[model samples]
Target: MLGDGSLGNVGSPPRVGCVAGVFDLFHVGHVDVLERARRHSDRLVVAVLSDEWAMDAWGARPFVPLLERAQIVEHLRCVDEVVAVDDVRPEWLTGVLGVQTVFAASATDGVLGVDELDGIPPGLITVLPAGRGSRSPILRAAIDQRQSRSSVA
Candidate 1:
């Protein structure tokens, strides 16, 4: 568990599943995806995107820092392990982390953009539907922007 600051292997499960994301502002949608992913495999590994990757990919730095985001994810019951990932490439997740299945939220509910799915086999990926707890980081960001502007005005 990354919360304890240890990256020790949790031993191989019947199936090892992975979900990678920035996890900038933890929300119900994040919990929804993690718990759902855990159901598909015996163990779940969450990859918290590094600050650099989040900034470069989104053109905006994460509201929460990388290590903090990782620690938050590590404490989740559904996650067996949390790792810091600079890249979302399939080879890195499979070759390095030994992930058997990759769980991802659909475009509307996805923190990881579609480009991150490139090169991964379709069969190896599980796309969770946009659930009641949908990923609305964009909406959150807009609200924050409006609030900030009002405050300044």
Candidate 2:
């Protein structure tokens, strides 16, 4: 996602916090993560990765386009800012946004190490509880089940 603050109204910054993701398919699990991020700070910045960035990082294009995905996040009341983050190293993003805290799902792996975490400059790292059925395998199973039913119909 590009780091341009375009989601919420410009105010006094408001102890900004953040959560970043590919946000493919705009699932309920994504909403839960954003909502949880909002609770930790007055202003929540949801970083939606760009298509090029997603392909580079994840080896595939995202299910949703960057503009549409960003709009979804921008419209949410819980989100105070929406930015495009394209960093290979995300810890730098926390420092750029002046975030007070950074939230991620408990299921997340490969997050910044202690040294990388310290480089955040201002944000405190926090992990939220992993929501039920939020994992890729579980979500894929649910989607497959729905698709199978539709095919039968």
lDDT of every predicted structure (CA atoms) = 0.77, 0.64
Best by TM-score: 1
Candidate 1 per-residue C-alpha lDDT over 1-153 given as tens digits, one digit per residue, 9 for 90 to 100: 422323334762457789888887788778877887777777689988898987787787787898899999999987889999887777787888888888778645445534576677887787776654654667777878998999999
Error of 1 at 105 (Å): 1.0
Model 1 CA deviation exceeding 4 Å by range: 1-13, 107-110, 113-115, 134-139, 142-153
Model 1 residue 9 distance off true place after TM-score fit, in angstroms:
21
lDDT of 2 by residue, 1-153 (tens): 112334344654556777777677766667777776676677777767678876876676766788888887789877878887664244555557777666666433212223333344433667767664346546656887897899999
Q: For model 1, give the 10-residue run with minimal summed lDDT.
A: 1-10
For model 2, give the 10-residue run with minimal summed lDDT: 107-116
What's the CA error at residue 48 for candidate 2, in Å?
0.9
Model 2: pairs clashing at backbone N, Cα or C within 3 Å: 1-49, 1-84, 1-85, 2-84, 2-85
TM-score of each: 0.78, 0.65
